[model samples]
Target: MVEAVSRNSFKAYDIRGKVPLELNSTVAYRLGRAYTELFQAKKVAVGRDVRHSSPELVKALTEGLLDGGCDVIDIGLCGTEQIYFATFHWQLDGGIMITASHNPQGYNGMKLVRANARPISGDSGLRELEERVVTSAFAEPVGAHRGNVQVCEVMPDYVQHLLSYVDIAAMRPLKVVVNAGNGCAGPVIDALERYLPFSFVKIHHEPDGEFPNGIPNPLLPENRDATAQAVRKHGADVGIAWDGDFDRCFLFDENGDFIEGYYLVGFLAQAFLGRFPGAKIVHDPRLTLNTIEITRQLGGVPVQSKTGHAFIKERMRLEDAIYGGEMSAHHYFRDFAYCDSGMIPWLLVLDIMSREGKTLSELVQERIDRYPCSGEINRRVSSPQVVLESVEKAYAPGGQIDRTDGISVEYANWRFNLRMSNTEPLIRLNVETRGDRKLLQRKTEELLVIIDGFA
Candidate 1:
């Protein structure tokens, strides 16, 4: 009998868990072989983030892939998007990124994609992949016919593609503070610096697997202070910070005020609609008024998709949307294989600031005032489903209900979305009002009361 491999890391979207016990090199090696056999992938590209365990995991993963007669192009030490870029840009068979992506230091994970950079999630292929790995179902390696590994550099070409999104010559020189959070974005920023005309004030900019400053998640209130302070200290036009794998980026205004990601969705949609008139823009269900209103005002279609990268990308492909954004800071581009990029959003924001001769705050303030939101608040509970149904039962009668990804009830002046977390026993809540801060506060508390009652 084969010893069982832990399946704890196999999430709905990707594989992520604590290292050694949950996701060791043994598990990675088996996954590689199983992935090769399942997809019959001939040419695969693999990349890793700035995590200590990543290198070892990549080695074992590559060995298994090679054993299964798959040629491996190792794009060493890169953000998650770089693997996506390599897969689609080079027209390779598949790609795997070894990154836990803003998870704590002792954790690591992998994000897989097939040709054209299409996501491979639980409903897609990850479940089948998990079964194979668990059962040790893989063909024996024929040593004589094993494939080879090649180390390839993708930065120069990647930088060129990033610059193609905006007119560099039209951009004005502005002071910008960039916090890499000791992740993989620093190198990409360095590569793009020579081509752009901005003075960058770098903080924790170096890529360190140790994550000396912290785990690099800017979504947490405490993790945002560094970037905000830098922006104020330098009097920069805007401040940008990215997570461990540099997949989702967060922004801060000139006064060190953190700009909510919901507003940025509308901000980016407006930018794209300005250039590509009547284009379709995809947004998540968490927050919608600002994005929908802005998209409509600009004569662009706003398509709402369920939250998560796979769903958003699929929706974008179905709609052929010009852009897709989740309030969580994941921005997807049609040209970039409908894949999210932490780098692209900032570049576009800067371009908008440059051309309009406006500060980052000025560009997004109108939308913020129009849609005051209670940013995603999470509460631990005994039964998340019970709480969701309770909230829905209470509010569904009087409001317009949307059950796309979660329970969203919209009234005349206020709207709220209450959804259960995919990985935790927590219910995530988001409330927004039509320019009413007081209403936003009251409803948020009211919903919390209902949630706390269940607790």
Candidate 2:
């Protein structure tokens, strides 16, 4: 049995915690054993970010993998997606990525994938792995079936795969600024642009484990300033920035305005549906009407799935969805084995601009005007269930209620969703009204009052 630890360390999606206090070499070693035993994986691909603590944790994890009789292939200092590529490219039985994504520098985590890049989450296999880790119930190998380590570079193929999705030759000359936020995206973007025709302006494009600028999460308003400022300063056509692992991307228009991810979803859905008519496109429940309308207009089917990457990817694979998107900037594609890419969305959007001869703002303006939303507001509350109940009761008389992903109250002219975060003690609220920004603001304020009342 693995050693006992705090339940707080085992998160909903993966194992993440602060180093030394919550996560340490011991924990990593135990997790390695548990993962290998659970998957019966003979070979595992391992990768880490440019964090100072990453090397130590990776070494411990690798030692445990070898102890569990699983061979390890170490891809040093790589983004999370490259580990996914390594898993499939090398035909490894499983993969483990040591990264906290856009989390603070003090935090670290691991994302696991089964053979063929299949995700292992709490519901699928992570819970069992956690239990094994807590108990340390690993069996010893019988013979000399020890694992070996190898190093291979997977970036060239990954970049080529991303570029394959868009036609760079047909792209218009675009002045683009990419802020890597001093994260792992630097090397990948440098390699990718060498073959493209666009004029690229790079910022914070070097991997600094110290994170001198700030945490690389673009969802936070403060972190977006560098990219937004760059867009205006350079008079660029568009600006793009990625999180720590480069899993999701955020965008700014020529005017340096932050474009919401929902609008991007609608735009990309339209683009893919144009090519694959009548195909299904998946979207999270947070922004339903815009995606549904856009998909219908483009002669495609719109399917709403629960939030988060794992759920979206599962639905995409089951339904063979050509594309899947979340209000948060995660965009998944069928061409990429139903995996989400921080790189591909921007590429496709640029292609859309070149083909339509329209600016990014112009392409998404209609959808944004039609479905004005008060971007997701998070409230810390003592009782999330009670707050949800209050909102449901208050709105139940006027419209339909959906508990699909969260508590979604729908009316003819407007709708909103109030859902609790899986990883934190907060409830996320997203409100949208039909072509009325003021109404969305009003409803949002009212919902905030109700949520605050529970506090």
Q: Write down the lDDT of every candidate, Cα atoms only.
A: 0.93, 0.88
| Candidate 1 lDDT over residue span 1-455, tens digit each | 66689999999999998999899998899999989999999999999998999999999999989998999999999999999999999999999999998999799999999999999999999999999888975667998979899999999889999999988998999898999999999999999999999999999999998888999999999999999988888888889999988899999988989998888899999989998999999999999999999999999999999999999999999999999999999999999999999999999999988888999888888878889999999999999999989998899998999999879999999999999999999999999999999999999999999999977
Local lDDT at 132 for model 2: 80
Query: Per-residue lDDT of 1-455 in model 2, one digit per residue for the tens?
Result: 34676555688777788987888898898888888888889999999987888899999999889888889999888888888778877788988999988887788889888887888888999889888877766677545876778877788888888898888888999999999888899998889888877899999989998898898999988788999999999999999999998888999999999999988998899889888999999999887889999899888999989998889989999999999999999999888778788999999999989988999889888889999998888889998888888888888997988887879989999999999999778999999999988888888999899999977
Off by over 4 Å in 2: 140-143
Q: CA shift at 12, candidate 1, in angstroms?
A: 0.5
TM-score of each: 0.99, 0.97
lDDT of 2: 0.88
Task: Estimate candidate 1's alpha-carbon lDDT, on a 0 to 1 scale.
Answer: 0.93
Candidate 1 segments whose C-alpha is farther than 4 A from its true place: none
The candidate scoring highest on TM-score is 1
* TM-score, predicted candidate 2 vs. hidden true structure: 0.97
